[model samples]
Target: MPKRYSPQVRAEAVRLALEHVEAHGSAYAAARAIGPMVGVHYETLWMWTKQALSERAWRAQRGQSGVATPPAG
Candidate 1:
């Protein structure tokens, strides 16, 4: 079975991954670097980051702040 992570953990991982992306190269790299430290799989973290970032961009196009709840999967 897949492991279940809390919303707070998802958010933090997404946040860290984004920061890592800004400082580094790609989201994959961010995930690879941050996942182990946060106890999440790299692929999982990357997906969460991608989703959050896409949502953020979608919200930005409408002039809204990014405060979306990560979707449950």
Candidate 2:
């Protein structure tokens, strides 16, 4: 079975991915840099980053409507 990550570990992976994006400006590069911290594979990090960005965009849209719905899986 694959290992499950704790919330703290997920947060750390996200943080590391963001830092890598800031430094390298590419998801592939960011994934390579951030993958080890939480045992996320590079492909998984890419998917997570894409999901995070989409969620952020959705929240911004909902914020304009004054209704902040949680992200859907």
Candidate 3:
């Protein structure tokens, strides 16, 4: 079976990946660095990072524009 991570773990991983984005030059690179420490695969971490950022942007824009956004999936 695949390993399962809790919501808090996922959120922390995403936050860590974002903090390192500038230093690492991209989400993928940040994930590569943070993944081992957080016990996640680089690719998985990168995807989570991307999703978090996308949702944040979507919400920010929705607040400003007062428009409904479509589901990311």
Candidate 4:
């Protein structure tokens, strides 16, 4: 059975993964390095990191164009 994680835990894992990716320039490497420490599968952590980064990029783009982001569901 898959274990459930709290939102705080998920957010922290994403943050760590993103930091690792920024430092290493590779999501795969970031996941491999941080996943075990955080008790998440590398692939799962990578997906979370990717989604967070993508959302940030979208927000930045909208900000540059002076548009507001729709509230996330």
Question: Who wins the TM-score comparison?
Answer: 3
Candidate 4 CA-lDDT value: 0.84
The lDDT for every candidate, in the order shown, is 0.86, 0.79, 0.90, 0.84
Q: Which candidate is the best by lDDT?
A: 3
Cα RMSD of predicted structure 4: 2.7
Q: What does candidate 2's lDDT look like per residue over 1-73, in tens digits?
A: 9767787877778778977787878877898878976688877787778788778789898979888777778
**Each model's TM-score, in the order given?**
0.81, 0.69, 0.88, 0.82
Q: In candidate 2, which residue ranges exceed 4 Å CA deviation?
A: 65-73
Ten contiguous residues minimizing lDDT sum, candidate 3: 64-73
What is the number of backbone collisions in each predicted candidate, taken in the order shown? 0, 0, 0, 0
| TM-score for candidate 1 | 0.81
Clashing pairs in 3: none
Looking at model 1, residue 40 earns an lDDT score of 98
Model 3: lDDT to the true structure: 0.90
Error of 4 at 41 (Å): 0.6
Q: What local lDDT score does residue 28 receive in model 1, on the 0 to 100 scale?
A: 87
lDDT of 4 by residue, 1-73 (tens): 9878889989999888887897877887898899899999888888777778778888888889988775353
Worst 10 residues of 2 by lDDT: 2-11
Q: With candidate 3 superimposed using the best TM-score fit, by how many Å does residue 51's alpha carbon deviate from the native?
A: 0.4
lDDT of 1 by residue, 26-64 (tens): 988999999999999999999998888787676775565
How far residue 70's Cα lies from its native spot in candidate 4, in Å, is: 7.0
